[model samples]
Target chain A: MNEQEAAALFGALSNDDRLRVIRALVRAGPDGLAAGEIAEAIGASPSRASFHLSTLSEAGFVHAERQARSLRYRVDFDRIGALMRFLLEECCAGHPDLRSCCGS
Target chain B: MNEQEAAALFGALSNDDRLRVIRALVRAGPDGLAAGEIAEAIGASPSRASFHLSTLSEAGFVHAERQARSLRYRVDFDRIGALMRFLLEECCAGHPDLRSCCGS
Candidate 1:
């Protein structure tokens, strides 16, 4: 990803609630979780969860699918992978110390 | 790194200028660069670079050391490693796809 994209992705992750939401989705795995289920899991109101999920979706960190009555949110592993690569390779310049942390 | 710390670190990285400063510092390596040098390298004004550097320093991504007449800024590899680990392990929950991106 380019620096601008990286900055925007980081901006999406700059909130505590969003981070919590991402973690919740990660735990939910590929099947994902409905909006209300995510809200209950993260202790956020449905509206607050929806707001953060929308921000994450716009940033390409998460994807939503209409299942029955609500949207099911899932973490986008490929996008997240690209983000980590950008941080480790571009930002860190593949520093050996930082690379080792990634088990590279 | 907890969710709050990760959010704060991502917040520090949310700016384009700050991202440029970080990439410049990574290129500069362990010897680091003074504020004036970093400003020039990133094409930012001295004051602008100083402001972003202060934010990065406060967030523990970079640390400043008094070196003669100026403060030399360097990326904290350990802290950065921790942040990456937080994203890959904690946020991603050690997902195989994400782990592979980290070369784990």
Candidate 2:
């Protein structure tokens, strides 16, 4: 990803509530969690949770699917992985020893 | 890193100037670059670069050290790697195929 895309992804994750939402979804695993569960887990209002989730989704950090009536959200692993790779893309260039900085 | 630490680090990276500064420093590699060079490379004033550099350093994304008169700055790869790991800690919690989310 380019700097602007990475910046946008980081911008989506720079909030406490959004981070909490991501962690909760990560813990929830493949089944994911409904909006109310996420709101309750993160101690955020329903509307606030919805807003943050939408931001995360728009940034490709989270995926939302309609399950029955409520929408379920799950962390978008591939997108997140791409983000991690973007952050460490060059990773000290060809200095193999410097791989520690790239997280090995 | 914990949620707060990760949040702070992401907060530091959320700005465009800081992101450019990081890309410049990453390209500079081990020798690093003086504050003035970073400022020029990123099209930022010395003071502005210094402020963002300080923020990145405080968040453990960059390291600064004095060499002669000017301080040189470099990306702290290990710290950055740790941050990446923190973001992908669970990685689908044992679903091997889901490893894609962790940036495999």
Model 2, runs deviating above 4 Å: A90-104, B90-98, B101-103
Best by TM-score: 1
Give me the TM-scores of chain B across the candidates: 0.93, 0.88
Please list the C-alpha lDDT of all candidates, in the order they appear.
Answer: 0.88, 0.77
Expressed as tens digits, the lDDT of each residue in A21-70 for candidate 1 is 88888888779999999999989888998898899999998998999898
lDDT (tens digit, per residue) of candidate 2 on B5-81: 78788888788788888778878878999999999999988899889999998898888899999999988767766
Worst 10 residues of 1 chain B by lDDT: B95-104
Cα lDDT of model 2 by residue, A26-71, tens digit:
7897899999999999999999999999999999988889989999
Indicate which candidate wins on DockQ: 1
Q: Give the TM-score of candidate 1.
A: 0.96
Docking class of 1: high
Instruction: Provide the lDDT at A65 for model 1.
Output: 90
Q: Which candidate achieves the best lDDT against the true structure?
A: 1
